[model samples]
Target: MFRLSSLIGCTVLFLISCGTSKKSFVMPSAENISAVKFLGEYDIPYNLLYKNTVVGGLSGIDYDKKNDCYYFICDDRSDNNPARFYKAKIFITPHGIDSAVFTDTRSLLQPDNTVYPNKKQDRLHVPDPEAIRYSPVLNQLIWSSEGERIVKEKDTILANPAVTSIGLDGSFKHSFELPANLTMHATENGPRQNGVLEGMSFANNYKTLFVNVEEPLYEDGPRADITENNAFIRILKFDVASRKNTAQYAYKLEPVAYPANPANAFKINGIPDILNIGTDKFLVIERSFSTGRAACTIRVFITDLHNATDIKNIASLKGNSSFVPATKKLLLNMDDLGIYIDNVEGVTFGPVLPNGHKTLVFVADNNFEKAEKAQLLLFEITE
Candidate 1:
């Protein structure tokens, strides 16, 4: 979910299929996983104030194994406060997520050491912060910003999307060099607003990074609708050391789960966050929401790039059949849990349970809505 109003891989193997040819495949150990057990949920009181800042739009989250804590990027866009992230400690018991306490908050600073301003202050630089990841190797937090694209206003503003890393204290560290395609344009020739650069994660033992756009770019194809089952989005890979995009691959997005009310209300289905589980493999989240629906439909899937074609140089993917998209398999659907699922945008591996089983945690962005509740859900990976 991008708007404030909308309450929104591991083991690669090579195989020889034909006598004279070789085909690559990824068979992650997670494929053998038997079930996902829902533990419990904790709601961060609506608009809970911490460090004098209103905390609600928690869009992206990452587990800091070294510090035994978590870092969450707020999709605040510097509206209520400067674009920022929070360090928090979420205590998880066998029964559920017991409690959560905010430890610290830091404003993401620009190269000039100033906090990002709101659109009203600087329309060009106002950032729509979406996803964040903690790089233990660099001891920094990397985040993505869906920069402004104001076409309706008299003054045109086009702040290209960005991916940047910051020091532990939120000081500027480095800005990634993005490709030309990610730049926002005046016409519908590039990324759609609020649909670019949403999910990111560290892969290949922190040597490589992966980031994906929420929806397809204009040149790629059409936005996902109730009947568009083959909508495609690009996932960009980066060499962490160089901080440049190395390759890009297409991933198919599932169709919109439900039809919008009144036949034209707001509705969408797109990826919000991702997690690296093994080499070249990841866990992806597909969130779908439509107007007049009581809750969002969230699906967790596993995908890998072993057989996927790199589309970095391909200008368009519409009706293109020369490339193969990453293979995906459904793992879990939030609707099956029988719980009220909000706009879930983040997912990460949590601390191991006392029973020795690994854990998975998900967080929801409330969009700071008074009627909505910010949630933290826990689950056990029973293999």
Candidate 2:
């Protein structure tokens, strides 16, 4: 009887120990991050040519930890060259960003084992590459393309946005089955032109995937302007193993930063990229550009889905307020930095610094224009 009683006591103690361990384990979150200090900026010369391809339109960037290098996707749309990504070695020091050297370039392949053709060649498959992330778990690189949506009186070229996995060598792997709402339609019912699948990141130890749109869908609401403050964009969650979008949440965008030059030019504000800091928490980049403005307004915000309602099943968010959107807190604004910020579109967490603080990097899209510059900015995270 004593032996049985001792055994039972040991089992109870073990159970209590397990419970304590579980309770003590705290998940890492954006709350732990306090602020970020600007480190330095590096600008790649305009119209730099490498491997016979123009090195511009660097809209998306990701760092490969194992290789200690960076991959930048060029949103050339096959106009200058075949749709491609470039690998480079960026040198970062305590003082600031030293320089970036191009190492290699690879053409992103299609399922047909051919590179994406330009619009004049094949209007249906012209890829507008935007965001990219390197997955150590899958040992592959995942990229997003905001597919074309052109509707002419006689010619309609519509291609669905895509999130595809590719081998490290840039070979096509597979694609995730996107939700139905992402479909492109000629009418005003689906994603707006050049607004789908702007940014993506892996979360939950690469088990879950998150991709966001550049703007609100037609059914969601009207685009962000000087008057509207209720434009809602969707952040989609995908189960990596299943390669399917599982859930989605709505995120409201701020109004346009500034009015257009002629009061009706081009003005826009939307999420351009996002990075996962912890469980359901992300660092989002909201880029605002107004016509006739010399530079863009770039802001970094940290958001979480702790109390956000899942809006995956909801058809439209035009006038709906029944669901709570993700909670957001501003982290940084480039305007306050007193520096000219370009069209900054990409954000990613870099390697830790010697002081043990984390590093964050942002890259700008030059649009292959001589007027704009391909810029890279570095920041050190403060706890």
Candidate 3:
């Protein structure tokens, strides 16, 4: 019976249906994703920028460009109660890369290998971690544990791959295991279907370890998964001295017109842009959560890894290409790199750019935030 202009038009139609129902993570008009001109696109120009960040942001990043400095980790628990134990290392510059002043603290996750043996076995106690890398002849430190929960659909959360050797002063040497189920399938459609694995890279001396699996999550319009297939790129290969699984390659992310169906492709989800680019060549980072753009594609393989038989297979390789007419064509198209990420979880490759070619980096793992949003997007692969 109230008629104050019909109670302000029913409170303006209840605030326009609560603002179209809480979906504003930035879908502006669908294909309007931009973030690759930095100060030119994102505008972080202040003195050219570069100050701190030794271990304040990193959800998943792995770099061992023969040793320039990189082996970071930050999945969460500094205050959430796992107690607090993040890994670290940083200080490489061309323009952006900082995180190294760590006199030495010691907390690289450890619950008990010896339970702390003497307090240095690379320490321990981790969960829901993202990614990290480094192997030098078996020096150790090749991890991955992309674990997350809360599903109404398909559920089968399986992610486990670890190995530590710890030394540099933090201590911890020789931890093992990485080969059995091999993990990272993505979906069959049930529990909480998955496209999970978390990016990683290492082949020069890390024996062999290249894993990246994130691609799954759609609304049907980002290009519509081309049409709709399944969503793939398992590409596993772990030996690291008999850890097993010498080969296993799965590639399915060739979206074009749609209906590609591995099951209906489109779920690299995010965070995995690995790189090795040499012998069997490797440099994978294809992000396009529906045309938002983010690709570093380049994977030429014929693996034999000396002999490991299971080269699984991933032959023809070469980077991504397509950005018609140039000028970002419509706010989305990648050549070598593109960053304006909302969900770019991890990528690694460093050292060798003086006309030699090689220095690509990327990290984004905000899942430590649940819905997702923790960034560390860096780039370089020129020459």
Candidate with the greatest lDDT versus the true structure: 2
Please give the lDDT score at residue 222 for candidate 3: 24
lDDT (10s digit) by residue, model 1, range 252-335: 999999999978999999999988877677889999999989699999988888899999999999988999999998989999
lDDT for each of the candidates?
0.88, 0.89, 0.43
Residue runs of model 2 more than 4 Å from their true location after superposition: 1-31
Name the lDDT value of residue 68 in candidate 1.
Answer: 89
- Would you estimate the TM-scores of all the predictions? 0.91, 0.92, 0.27
Model 2 lDDT tens row, 1-383: 37988999999999999988752222123446889999999999998999999999999999876678999999999999999999999999987899999999999999877999998998888899999988777789899999878888998878999999998778999998989999999888789998989988888877788999999999999999987669999999999899998888999898888998999899899899988888788999999999989899998888998799999999999999799999999999999888889999898777778988878889999999888979999999997
- Which stretch of 10 consecutive residues in model 3 shows the poorest summed lDDT? 320-329
| lDDT score at residue 27, model 1, on the 0-100 scale | 18
Model 3 accuracy (lDDT, Cα): 0.43
Which pairs clash (backbone N, Cα, C closer than 3 Å) in model 2? none
Per-residue alpha-carbon lDDT of candidate 3 for residues 1-383, written as tens digits (9 for 90 to 100): 77899999999999999988854221001011122222111111221212222233354555544545566665543333231124335554556555443332334545342222211222223244456665554445655554443333554333333444454433456544544343333443211223445666666445566665554323111221554554434456666566555665444454542122354444333325555545545545554453333332222121222322232433211121111110101222333344345555555554543444344455544443434444454444322
Please estimate how well model 2 matches the true structure, expressed as its whole-model Cα lDDT.
Answer: 0.89
